[model samples]
Target chain A: MAKENKEVLLQVQGLKQHFPIKGSRNVIRAVDGVSFDLYKGETLGLVGESGCGKSTTVRAIDQLYRPTAGNVLFEGVDLATLKQKPLIAARKNMQMVFQDPYGSLNPRMTVSQILSEPLQIYSQRKIINMTKEEISRRVDELMEIVGLSRFFKNRYPHEFSGGQKQRIGIGRALALNPKLLLLDEPVSALDVSIQAQVLNLLDDLQKEFDLTYLFIAHDLAVVEHISDRVAVMYLGIIAELSPANDLYVEPLHPYTQALLSAVPIPDPKIERTRERIVLEGDVPSPDTERHGCYFYDRCPKRMEKCKGSIPELKAVKGDHQVACFLYE
Target chain B: MENKTILEVKDLKTYFRTDAGIVKAVDGVSFRLDKGETLGLVGESGSGKSVTNMSIMKLIPMPPGKIVGGEVLLDGVDILKLNEKEMSRIRGNRISMIFQDPMTALNPYLRISTQLIETIRLHQGLDKAEARKKAIEMLKLVGIPAAERRIDAYPHQFSGGMRQRVMIAIALSCNPEILIADEPTTALDVTIQAQILDLIKDLSEKLETAVIMITHDLGVVAGMCDNVCVMYAGRIVERAPVDDLFESPKHPYTNGLIQSIPRLDEKGSGRLFSIDGQPPNVIDLPECCPFHPRCEKAMDVCTRKYPPVVSLEGKREVACWLYEENK
Candidate 1:
């Protein structure tokens, strides 16, 4: 839960990312008018399916992809309008951990080299000529933070296992001591046994470093486990946002309810007894513009009011916001 | 023969001759499936769940992959001893399989009607028109709307969920006695996964077809399987009824796997219960219990040798040193 007195570290206002086709007028509306806030020391989980724009939203916020429209405010300053030097300085406080541990880290470089590269890049801005001793000490500290031993620092990324490779990725992300971590499905690629280990390590690191995280994943169980607040995305828009437990227990949006019900429980007795709400049809293509709700085509409880107009996200309960008109 | 067992695997051992060494993919795995029953083969990436099913199918390539020792009895007949001609006849007609990715399993260039009808023609020996008619019926049976019009479309034209439905339609067209669905719904979204699971369950019941569902997800096993076999490092560590396994798992590995996954119905302690180490390397596994290094309750004996299967009441069985004394 976010404390009332905590400062808003990052605020995303109406973030839209649209990619235009080269030969056609069609645009892939990846992220459309998404908004959210992150407290100084909290994990905000962004949950959605593959094409739901959670990845695009995170990239836009990280400035990996500039937004087609709207603004990403990091401590009340728009990242889109910042100068090159200022943006580089601002990015020093924010870091992103990618999904594929194998592809995200450089395969050619040793763990020591990978960890030192970030420090070397940021050293010129800090204006301190880093001595070899200081860089080596920092690398050892980073490896220790991510539960890797100093003995294996010289090994390349290929020599390490999937879990160990993920540890290196996390270590490199923390090399510069960033305040906010944009973790995009960090544990999804790992095996179940190793996933839990990496997840625990991440939880511990967040507290130890006083870091805020924008955690993105598709697994509802994982998101509910780690997130203080959970946002459900559908067709490039946030369908609902609520406290993690509350969202799980009593979801406001139809899409959220369907997603929750679809997660098969591990207990056979409970799984057999529970009624599942299987939505009809596939997710519509994002290239086509829908006049109303993105979920209107599949929603069973859809009505006349659901067509020809979009519904803005409004608070339905305490700290629970839904974009559906059912609450109204 | 007296029992209702539809498929029985006895001492299945599959190995691969790699550059490093002989990798024991499925080391002495055994299980049984009755008529109309679903047996879930649950395991991690290298745990050999897929290899076990492939060995049964006689699909392992001979040069590198070999089924060195095993008897896959489909209705009291050894499938492994059968020649290539005999195996091919039985493969699609009696025991069929649906792969993980429908896009790859389906040919991109061919029409949906072509792929589905070819299987029907091959298995049932029906003529072109009859096979095409049966294919459309199968498509409608799996819940693809406008089957007549969409039958001419290519695999890319259909959505992921619909392509999977087409795959399921092709798998179930011949109404095989056994269906091997290896992660059938893993590629689809959750809502679509639910629909596909329901369709499989409903269709299997109607046709009285036994299913061998291979997947890593415990949740899918809980909903779909009557019996569950938890595989770790090429061995069945635990086997029991789904309810029994969920309520009281005996093996330390099974317990760890259950605890490691976050449950949607319950709020966790914030600190996740994680298993300590990676799965043992199959190429050069230790002689002792392979999971002893990571098992929290590992005794001295656990590190010395692999434990024998300890049978308990209610058809429950576990291979662990903790239960060796009880046995």
Candidate 2:
């Protein structure tokens, strides 16, 4: 396939990762044949259900789980085929900010040691063995950057609240100063008031550092908030991909339509007026095989051909790609 | 226009006695629920939304958590007056709860039927066969197909959304007049969360049951609730009709929350209006308004003295000094 402007920072092509089921010979298609392009300085929100390969795709991109097939070209280098040393070296340019602040960090490590470990692994010797004054200054700078106070440096994860702890997580991620940050539901675990603070902090940091984000979340409202472009994934495929505004207001795929309808609009009047598209049935197990569309069972506008042949992602409008039989 | 109080919580304060110091989780929180109406308890985590709900049901333990003050009245009957045996009998029979994580709520080893039957027999006083019959009905009511066959399946056999349905079915098994749902769809995907919310709304309407939905998502409350109570630092900061709360939120904390939430409609808006400070420690909550530390419209009185509830006509009450400006 031919590409447009070369501003693309990461190009994921036909990424497939299948985790073998415990006893059964069948493989759970955690992420299968997924493809998307993330541009420089753009926040691409990946929205989906719990089991849907959103997390797996991000993990695969981070090289935590190597893809069984396909390619992840990071800055024109194929990361899927890289070995141990090169992969770890490539990791310097890519950092992952996990979801649970409490579970993500080692509880035993103080905030100072936690931040310094990354610096020791990636930074120079002179920078590593700097005086206590210098180390505290650097940690304080990072802490202040994430809106955390200087006093929180010596505190453990148990001492700080969920929101304050997440700030420390963000500070550690920024320590690497990577070009790309893979945020996996970064603010989902925090409280509503704290979520906004962290989100605003992320926005400010992104602008200041010119960082590109692969923002993964389950909530469309938060996704719509930060994403320049959005991708709707179901069972392990990109069902809809378009700019955030175009995708939310004028969704082409039935799944996208239902997802938009399902979100409870914060306005009571609008909510009362809006007809909800309550989808029937549960998400099929990833191990289950489908002949055509992944969303066919619950899709409101499911067509006969939707079962006959798997629909390919075709452009419904300019820059709007949808994989549904309705377009055909 | 009508006063039909289903649940009346009076000066309800549930404190967790920890070694570091006592955590005054639900500090002097008071509210009323009307029959067939939805009241939303909105707050960030640790604001005690869940703690308040748990205390009303007497789920909080003694060593760590205790309801130190106030009475919880349900249909003119003070639930707090009941002893352990009485409280146990009334719980799950009069009022039920559905949690955020369905997996944790349902037993993985037991069949869905076994779980549902236990709830039915314990509360409804049904025989084994009769409980089984009701379990089938509930499964069907929650839109689980082949309900009879699926009822015999384990929790692992069902999907995340279906397990949530089972949780709801168990919660509604006793047909309680009041249902307390604490972030019922928080971790689920967007589509599944939507369906669960839709189910709650449809079922609540059909049963004409009062619902106290505890959630951080303003979107969920806007759609499912008739009225909302915004809490911060263990205090109800604002209470109003859902629409009015959204259109004109008077409390600075409420104001901050509404602005901070990334809206589905507000596509190209700038960065969300984040509240500048953290929620104060519940143990060391401000003597004045709890939200005064982070409030943009904080006044001198806001720091030294607590603000009184200012009434706006039509059941809206805001606890903020800026509402005095409106007056």
Candidate 3:
């Protein structure tokens, strides 16, 4: 697929999400300033470690948390400026799938009720009008779509395994046929074999429904496998953004290089001889204000200029963009 | 460096008597840990990797959970046969275990110094002053900055990575012969995980402490373990040298696990090869091969009976009908 040929489904322009401390004046710049474009029917992976604002990015885009600053252009309409009623209407096109399958689904409700709740609510709100029989039919279709047996519709969440519960969650997300799905570490909780199954199901679902996805995960390998393009986030900002293959093959940012090196390959032969870049300390607190680049203190390739000013994400190659002095 | 078996588990069976029926959590698991050698127990959730270790540690809650049969031989002494008092001496002094979540493992109310000193004092019979000094030293060894000053701080004061380091510090304070690390870095980030793994690798080599690493992540197993045991439905399905296991896996489950993970080195847009069906429930599990239903190359015999363990070349052993003829 050509890059320029695809239409932009969601455009996040200089998005910032900041939360102030209760008693203190200090603010946590969770998603300081992020900008990206989600193309139609494409999966854009947001990869980062914990507290890197990957989840916050998805939430801000989904309007779960109103952004502190900047615009979210969804289908050429500014979602950031929309009121509660209009925002609710805009959200019909987008839906979120959470990480923990055990916690996500309601244990009390059966699979049918769990899947139908979203449809019922959306229909009641006049987002989409559907008859009860049609709702029942759609629920059955969703079960088939996510590879769950329709016979298990009356079963409670506790009866289902972790993988089955995840399928139910996916089915519920697809109830209204949302154009975009915000997958926030959907398969992280699952076992390796089950993780593979879910990943493959997501791949098939995207193709079958023509749904766009903003996949957020800490696992680089999983993201690379699914994402068309990858964005590596660090301390609330994207350090590098490129085509999935290009980013993994030739990482531009030092953080991306270090992160890539840190992940141990499954093969013992490769893992034994491979040199890992083990970062010295933990990620710095997001609450602390910094004048320089977010990665300056921990960065191995830190320069004098990096401490004085922040580096803007700039394109260095055809599709690879990096926010580092080395690239500049 | 001659290889010597320090810990030998012989036909260990830990079962849980649930309302549904007897859940064979760790059913007849057997393996040997060489001195200073890192042995990886690789399995998914409820595959009995954790139960096997817990049973060895004698930490399983009885009544509901019971070690029905087994012999955990440590230096020719059957630790499983020992009384509660006798086992307590061997628990931390000889064989220390670290859990996945450090927060839950460490007492939040107690200061770092209290926990560290208590373990050191109990095992080494050291005084408070000497124990505190050794605690700081152990903390420093695990790469905790300002160990002397932070020794009084609570577990909540430190970050997740630092807290894990504290757990490691306490675990290794006694300089145990065998250290059982059960998913120590699973709760951490990739960068922090690398740091923790490197520390463990370096410390194990320095202290000559044998490590039994139990984890679901094959990447961790590949990096840390000299030998690997792939568990399935509370049984050791396959056992092999780390290199041979990844190079040429004999069991269908091991092969499926390796094929399933998206590789960091490999660049492919194609669909990942996923094993069909979920892991079997262990409660009242049939006598036949548990993984046969999900196995790609399951034979007719696999459904009728459990496959016998076949010894292959390079010290590898696999329990599968596909390799039964090789026996």
Candidate 4:
């Protein structure tokens, strides 16, 4: 957990992704001024409600959608400034596993073909040179690593169940031996039992490859389980960033507290007795320009200053940062 | 306070006639719902949790899907035997259902007023003015702000959570005795899900309506339901009180499911306990236990035949070979 010696694998500084509406002057700021440092071989969990820009943060970091502002420093190299060829070259070190496993995989292609597509593309582009046999061998290894049988390589994606399809997705992501993996709600679509399987597989794969992960998911329990550090986002901003235990055990931000309280504990004795902090109203649309806090409307501990100015994420305790006027 | 049994489902068998064979969607599923008590049906997809509730509502489509056997006893009357005309009177009047996706469940083109008023008028025999007044009241009851104005707006104007609130309003407008909410909070965010769940819990208690919450989330089941029914491949694998089910699950499948979920309260960095193998495909399923392939304590008898339901102490019921001796 020491930060002095650990390398920063990815440094996202003031990253912003904004989409403009057609025939309108308004822009929907999906990811606005988010900053974080993902340590090497560590899982940094990004959690929030839907439309809170959790997915957009990772997508923007992956350069799936070019950020409107700020820098994405992957291994000290600024991905935001990189040109098309250099960006593609840099992308070889980072791969993204999308949320929907069913939609991500091509229905027509066989499992082997799907897993090998990345390798073939990389080899064709001279990013990684490998013969057809080597690619096939790597696919087999990937299938094994992801706990899928090599015999199922000939089967199409449609033949696999949700969990199996997700395994295939994970196998495809690990095809090029990327140092960093951007998992965007990878296990959300699967069942609880299968979700655990994929989570364990991801944990093992990270250890096996020494991969740094920016795990994006809404399920807080899953995030707590896999992440070394957790970041709670709200309407394109990090409300709180702390160690997984600290964030869960002693959350500073009101939004974080409310979010944690909302997640029902599986134990009935605990769930029935616990006091929940249910926030009022829906998440405001991200389109309108906001000078004040994004969560001002629903924040239970809102003040006059909270309505006038946005709070900066500052350290209240050791390594525990919160964005609220109360902390100030 | 005495508990009154409101509905009793006996040996329900709902099947789908597919090209491959008959898919036993909800085979031999039975449970009892007491008045004002919340019951939970927890299972993964294709485990027939949703189908069981749909059969109770008589909403299953014909030709492909059919309720071949079983009786859905409401109060004292067997509703499965009721004709289409008779079932129509009972469908929305006495029993109501809210679906998973509020967006698709609601009619986009129709105004909220029209949808709410139509249901109220059809069931309660209220006139236009009274029904319109009652519709706004229903909307207000579900915590929709400015219900009078929002009632006139179309469904597209509302957010996902607000849309779900509207769905609840419509479902509970008639004050149905039994409310079946099928994954009501699945499509909602945690904050919004909390709001919806709180509203449902509060309103159900206020209206004295029994709720059958069908979801895959054990957390939701633990918090909301009085009794929990764990389903695995078209049959109830286990049934117990919520506390007992979580604390000491009898069925292997239920125990696996309870342990598999990463708990919010527990602090652990260890690898999650996951069940091996996938749920069996229900198409042309055999008479043997479907979960035996994934169960760790699977015996020779589990592969040969399905285990009979065994009633244990504390009113728990389990359909596994491990509990067969207690039968």
> Weakest 10 consecutive residues, lDDT, candidate 3 chain B?
B318-327
The total number of steric clashes, by the backbone 3 Å criterion, in model 1 comes to: 0
Q: How far off is each candidate at the interface, as Cα RMSD in Å?
A: 0.8, 1.4, 0.7, 0.7
Q: Please give, for residues A175-260, the per-residue lDDT of candidate 1 as tens digits.
A: 88899999999988888889999999999999999999999998889999999999999999999998898999999899999999
State the lDDT at B113 in candidate 3. 96
Error of 3 at B227 (Å): 0.1
List the lowest-lDDT window of 10 residues for candidate 1 chain A.
Answer: A123-132
Query: Which residue runs of candidate 3 sit more than 4 Å off their true CA positions?
Result: A1-4
The true-versus-predicted C-alpha distance at residue B243 of model 3, in Å, is 0.3
lDDT tens per residue, model 4, A1-328: 4467888989999999999999999999999899989899889999999999999889899888899999999999999989989899899999999889899999999999999999999899998899999999999999999998899999999999999999999899889889999999999999999999999999889888888899999999999999999999999999999999999999999999999999988999998898999888889999989999888999999999999999999999998999999998
Query: Considering TM-score, which of the candidate structures 2 and 4 is the better prediction for this target?
Result: 4
Go through the candidates in order and give the C-alpha RMSD of each one to the true structure. Answer: 1.5, 2.9, 1.1, 1.1
Model 2: chain B TM-score vs. truth? 0.96
Which ten residues in a row are the worst by lDDT in model 4 chain B?
B318-327
Q: Record all residue pairs in model 2 with backbone atoms less than 3 Å apart, i.e. clashing.
A: none
Model 2 chain B — which ten-residue stretch has the worst lDDT?
Answer: B318-327
For model 1, the local distance difference test gives 0.91
B237-257: candidate 1 lDDT, tens digit per residue: 999999999999999999999
Q: Give candidate 3's root-mean-square deviation (CA, Å).
A: 1.1
If ranked by lDDT, best first, what sequence of candidates would result?
4, 3, 1, 2
Off by over 4 Å in 2: A1-6, A123-140, B323-327
Lowest-sum lDDT 10-residue window in model 3 chain A: A1-10
